[model samples]
Target: MAKALMIQGTSSGAGKSLLVTALCRIAKNLGFKVAPFKAQNMSLQSFITKNGGEIGLAQALQAMSAGLEPEIHMNPILLKADGNKGSQVIIHGKVYKTLKPKEYYAEKKKLWNKVLESLEYLKKHYELLIVEGAGSPAEINLRDSDIVNMAVAEYLKAPVILVGDIDKGGVFASLYGTIKLVGKSEKLIKGFIINKFRGDVEILKPGIREIEKLCQKPCLGVLPYFEELSLSSEDSLGLSYHKTFSSEKNKLIKIVVLRLKYISNFSDFDPLKYEPDVELLYSLRKEELLSADVVIIPGSKRTVEDLLWLKSLKIDKILKYLAEKGVEIIGLCGGFQMLGKILKDPEKVESDLKEIKGLGLLDIETTFYPKKITTQAEGYCNLKENLKIWGYEIHMGESEGDLNLFTIKRFATKEIKKEGSQKESIWGTYLHGIFENDDFRRFILNKVREKKGLTPLEKSYSYKKLREITFNTLAKLVETHLNMEKIWSLIKL
Candidate 1:
């Protein structure tokens, strides 16, 4: 087995994911081929691979840092939240089933064989594997069948690096309590790092010394919060996500997404955030979205509930205003389902809400279906704006609308256009990350300009360049705190 160091946390959002990412980058910088593994991940933020698989965005970031193509082996199990105490379970890039909390707990223990298989795959191939745990393993109630945190590290015999978020307070207590809670002080915990700290370093040294003494663990480093890195977050919850911009300057394209409760895959717009002059804004207030050059409706876990919620808050009126003002409107995935004549969940795929009326901007009707189309598809996109783009489709509904307006050609293994878009200023599609394609990206950027009666910006984007920049920053972050030589030694052993 390759040497390994697991980065576990006292709780969720303790900066474990970012630490793993930086470590992977730093390892690559030190000439070690490193890979990241998470035995289990329960989060809403997900990534669609070029090969049509799904995994958490955190592992994908780690893979990028390691200079490797993201694969299903990185995150063997991705549990996507589906609201009301349920999650869609994904095992090795395949949808296993939709399981309620209790139901999932029962099956998780049985899934360890598969988790071990993925870990072994990485262990044999990569020089090192940086593992991450799910939520706090300290939930004593959940210790019996702990598949994510302490259980996985113990299974792999990997030394643990406990990460605590001091910004939340109780740093010493959290570290001490976590070790006590796990009830296993085998001296396998190599060290610790304090993440998301603010203020003078001199003052924090005392706290760091105190933390080391209280936990009886080496204080590896105290990492101050740095916002300039522009690190893309793995989960939307409490994440400081920024939009991407192009190096070539141009007029700003202000695209505003309405932030709703229970948002599912809002990361679909992360690519857009990087666009130069394309200001991506997320608004929950109706008035705040009015001045946006383009109004977007992102996917929601509960489409019916969110639509009803939007209707209650007059989001329909605001969308209508943006449309009337000649502003561009784009609806993606679940958002596309809501833009049709009606979003009926007779089959209850998304929710139990019988049927809800849509915005009717696309002249389409969506029916919640029993079957899910979780496959990769590609094609051209041109309407009020001309663009040829490629993207992936994973949705649970059938849509019917004007096909001529928005032409869709799925790449492989399926022929279905249950949901689609319009040709005019308004467009809708049940596809996520389709804008990542250059042709599609150019079209949308130009359409935003077209809506504003402006010319398309000639400056283009380099996707590879952006990835490199992100990875480089992450590597520096690791070098700043982690012991690269020690981590590499762990990975090799």
Candidate 2:
């Protein structure tokens, strides 16, 4: 069996995921085969594996950091919130069922078994497994049925490193309290990692010493905040921290993404943040929507419900006005469905409503089906002929329209099919991560720049290359700041 080490956080956004990602890369750099595992992940940001399995985006990125292909075993259970329909529970990367909080907790025993199976599978394949815990392990109300956090650590006999965000304040209290709350599992917590610290480590030394003394565990390290850290967030809680660029003299393009109540995969636009001339912000206000040079309706887990939300806020009217003004508007996945003339859900796959009116930005219609399309796709832009692009599809609706945006094929399949629709300045596609493609994204952005009477950028940075660089940077940061000697000792490396 492979050695395992777990990273549990003091709170939801206490930087557990990034620490695991860094450790995975650190292990890989030292010539050890490493992998990331999460017993359960409740996040809207997901990635489709090569075999058409859906897993959390954080695990996928961590697998990349470890120089391994993403697999379902990395994240055995994924819960996606579906508005009034409760949460969509995925077991082993396939949709299991949708259940409310009470209903989900009722099946704790069964879910725990599945987590064990996945953990065993990863143990046999990799030399080291860096496990990430969800929320806080200190939830006393949830400890009885917990499948993640301390439960998984105890199951694998893995040493746990609890992390607390110093930037959130109460770091010492949070760490001390978490250890006290875990009860018998406190023995498994070998150390504490203080993350997102700003200013002098010398100033924090006294507090760190006190926390160590109180918890009877060493303070592994104090990681400084990295404003330039460009990894995809695990969930929506990190959305507010996204940089809002001012439409200043240097920033030419103002891209506004609608912050829907049920937004999923908002990280689809993360690539745009690297562009020097572009400014990105997520907002739902009518004034903000109307002021954008480019407006994007991102994917949502609950499409029909979010569309109704848009209507209630009168954001639907704003979108139409923007469309009439020739402002560039784009929709992705569920957002693509909302841009159509009508949406029909006869079997009620997504919602109770049989039919709902869309924004009518495109001359298209969508019908929800029981089966979801989850596949990696490659294609070329029809507008810029032969400009190749590739991305994954994760949607339950099929759109019918006369206008087509790209010619594509599913991975390992040769059947050519038309995907997406474009009419004038409005574009809609089911492809997630479309903006990650440098050539195609630049083509679309340059077109908008030309219309605004600004010079188009001749060259743009490669997002794929940037991701590799980011992984290395994170690994270097952890290695430099943290006591790797203690970390390796815990894993028996």
For model 2 the local lDDT of residue 165 reads 92
* Candidate 1 segments exceeding 4 Å error: 228-230, 239-251, 383-387, 404-419, 490-493
Q: Pull out the clashing pairs in model 2.
A: none
State the lDDT of candidate 1 residue by residue for 311-350, as single tens digits: 8988898888777777888888878888888877886777
Give candidate 1's error at residue 147 in angstroms: 0.2
Worst 10 residues of 2 by lDDT: 241-250
Candidate 1: give its CA RMSD in angstroms.
3.2
**What is the TM-score of candidate 2?**
0.96
TM-score (C-alpha) between model 1 and the true structure: 0.90
Candidate 2, 2-111: lDDT as tens digits: 99999999999898998998899888989988999999999999998888889999999999999999999999999998876789998987889999999999999999
Q: What's the true lDDT of residue 132 in model 1?
A: 90
Model 1 scores a C-alpha lDDT of: 0.75
